[model samples]
Target: MVNTFQQHQHAALPRANHDERARQEFTKSLKQFVQQGLLPGLTPVYQTRAAKAFEKEHGKPPADRWDIRKAMVKDLYFQHYAATNRIAQELLWEAVIGSVERQLPELEKAIADLTASNPAPLESDPAFPVPRYVSALDIHCMPGGYASEIDGKDIAQGAIYDRGVYLYAMGYMGPDNDDMGRSVCNYVKRKMPGFQPKRILDMGCTVGHSTVPFKEQFPDAEVIGIDVGGPCVRYAHARSKALGHDVSFMQRSAEDTGFEAGSFDLVVSHILLHETSGQAMPRIFRECHRLLKPGGLMIHADLPPFDLMDPFTQFILDNETYYNNEPFWGAMRDKDQIGMARDAGFPAETIRFDTAPMAIMEFAGADTTYTEDAAEALAEREFTAGEYAPGGGWEVLIAQKAA
Candidate 1:
């Protein structure tokens, strides 16, 4: 008989062409076998109409890496669509262990053979060092978060999450899962799908994951990605140039970007605020206000600070602050980005956009607040949608300035 996880995958079949369906099926089967017959389930939320719509659009055809950013935001958000992430996390380590246990002998022989022949180095040294910040150290359970090189310092992270997924993952660690630092930028691109800004600025764009998608979204726009990390910026720039995307990476602070006033039509960030101290948020908000043109917009895709949701949901979101290395997360959860944007001079009566169409999103409660037990259940079962909607975290909103 077909097993539970494989059964689940088939149950949630993706809407794609015959060949694409075949490929996805093959991929799933390979993953299942490779992981010793384990198949992670889809998120409870994956069954929503919005998710279905996204899957429909995604199933159509493949695009270049540049064009793939359009898919990045939704794909990142798709983490909540299946229960697979939880299993994937556990299985990934298993895969590593299995690779060691089963494939080690062959791997050793291959390594010896390659070393004897003198393998090639990928590239020369970078121009600068990756940045360090008070927030980055404590924000994501990743000390030296954005600065650590995949090859050296930590060794396991950089290549695994970013380069490994490539276009398939929008080259990021998913929403609020900013392993590649792309969360902030991908959120902006997906949220403002219609408006093509002339000049785009990505604040605190850790590794440029958040920055490159804008270039793909608006090929004509002058796109610049800035971050404090020297290594990440250097790596990001090199990656962009190699991929032929016209993007510029710089070393700068989001609190004070040091750009001319009214320089951009869109200024966006992803998962940036929670890491920043409460004192820093106001300044960063003010900076965007000054940099944006009269009709421009400033948007952020961040963890839902207690500001938007209910007491119960608020507490749940707050727990990440304790366990997830996000010291500033609770304060961010409590701060109002909409109110902050309005106060930041985004013009009163701002309009926020929801990426999922109303038909798919079913406009619900005040951030869908729930009880404490529900919240804990949510963290574990968050990837699924239909069942876990009561506990909210992946909140998506876009605030616009008056014309």
Candidate 2:
């Protein structure tokens, strides 16, 4: 299916020229082809041959995702599939990186110009220790790993992520890449009436793609987006301004944010947990519990656990850990998130997993390319293992602090 979704451009975004745009579009199309054309074939390849070969050799069928992985690795089709995905990811970043580098000076100036008049606070600390998990390697094959600064007040890595992630998701994240936050906001509004928060915080908010939606949804609330990446916060501040929101952006780690206790009424994160180390997730959860006031809420949107899916599906999703540079991708799925939340001081009875339907359909006719038909198609499709997002909705882990 042709992806009709398009990103809404702003001053902080890198302007791609004719050739660069073509290369970026090609990478997006290639990724789409891989997900649509190649991914489904894995099931047949495994059930018909790979599993049979493993059973023949081991005297039993493959037991779990690990066994599935071992069996699939020897298959030629799986090799091709994995190779193409890695190549496409590399190409996606390369295409956007070149575009950003070519116009780095111009992009920086645009960010400066846009941020200058914005009233929101943009705080950063040069001495803040970059966690080893983020600083050690380039996560998602990103060239600079989200924290690198090439020059003074550098925001190159953030710029690369801003555009690259759109292509990476194949534009399934809506025009502004705010679907996760928007979905969560919609969930709160519909599920919890009369629960308007006065103060809100978003943790690990890279580039503020998912951060701006909260300000838009709850205009009266004081919204702040925090991240450990300096460049990411800088770019997020500028991007938030360019998008016409006065949300605050700060360089802060969720594991130990210095905010006062009970400073916020609602704390949220989108697709952030799986990227953090095992030791950090629980700390982050505790911090969230501490940051929220009585009767407040903590909501995290991320991948569901391995126990919820079949072994074949688990193996397919685990490809991120092996091929991509996501170190905690697979192991994170095994973590006891509910138990961690309980330990974090959230009441056990208040903790539950729920689906926040994608707000894509709500974006229909909202000025971008999100046509009603296209949004419906995206929201109604079956979620394949390796697809960008689940079809029904994003899986959200939510808990409420004691009142």
Candidate 3:
């Protein structure tokens, strides 16, 4: 997380405020929103209605799809409400991230410090685990995105995160993750002419954000989500149990999940690749390959490759991939994932990368299906890369497994 000029806008030379009135008002509003507009009172009802409507259309729920209808309301309300208050979200992040953000300067200084300190590498120590990649440097802008279990309990650490986002994710950040969840779930439910998945697995399912969607999509499939974080697994279990979603969450590194080969009909991940090291990416793809049923599918939702990004948007969004605790993002875009998919044994033609239209066929008051005029089809085709608009970035690469 450099404060340096060119890189972070400060990376140019290396350098870099807000006011109190706007700050206090923003904080007050946030507190009010949390206290009054969010959580217990509001989210439950919203998610219930959303869930009931889906259940009405789909019939019964999967084992893990328990009371998720309730969780959905809280999740959605927070996302929509926060997006409307972008300025407030920025203020809040400045406040919440201040402590972690302060340590950024140390990263550059550490490079100098490590050199000056003369860390000895013994000739005999050929196997010493020196940091191998540029990714080890920033760690996705996270304080320690790459560290292996600083504490004995990696899940606890992740749960702390789950709690934080669960409580505070105000706008797009919340929805970017959850909107993908709802979109995927709703999409899986409607069926595109004729398609079906027998079993589904979600990778990097932090607190089940992406995993929950599959329940709505293929209600009959056995859905499982795996991640390295223990807190996320434990909490995901607890939350899913409460919500009545029968899905399973497990604490396992995505790299080597010990599941049966060809056991899953679909393996899914949302926004996980950018946060992982390039070296780790292939292993994850292979794991998905090992876990999928023959002709099963693997699809992921994440930021598009650099090929699709404009310079200005690229600089802005990519800057976060660097400074915002997601240092691996740039590397992920740089890597040719098609090769990885192929290495994992999928036919080149089988790997379908499409940015499915984000919206579902309909909402209650609207028409049952959304019509796509010629222009609309083109835009929908670009749904993965075009929706970021003037403010945010784009989405690309649905990346399905071969038939």
Candidate 2 on 1-403: residue-level lDDT in tens? 2348567777788989999999999999999989999999999999999999999999999999999999999999999999999999999999999999999888989999988967999998777797989999999998889788755488888999999999998987876777788778888887897999999999999999888889988899999999989999999999989888899999999999999999899999999999999999999999999999999999999999999999999999999999999999999999999999999999999999988877764434233455656655543422222222334588999999999
lDDT of 1 at 132: 43
**Per-model root-mean-square deviation over C-alphas:** 16.7, 4.5, 19.9
> Model 2, residue 377: what's the lDDT?
52
Per-model TM-score versus the true fold: 0.53, 0.94, 0.56
lDDT of 3: 0.50
Candidate 1 Cα errors over 4 Å, as ranges: 1-138, 148-194, 351-397, 401-403
Instruction: In model 1, state the lDDT of residue 15.
Output: 21
> What is the TM-score ranking, best to worst?
2, 3, 1
**How well does candidate 3 match the true structure, expressed as C-alpha RMSD?**
19.9
lDDT of 3 by residue, 189-217 (tens): 44343667777888878667667656655
How do these models rank on lDDT, best leading?
Answer: 2, 3, 1
Q: lDDT: which candidate is best?
A: 2
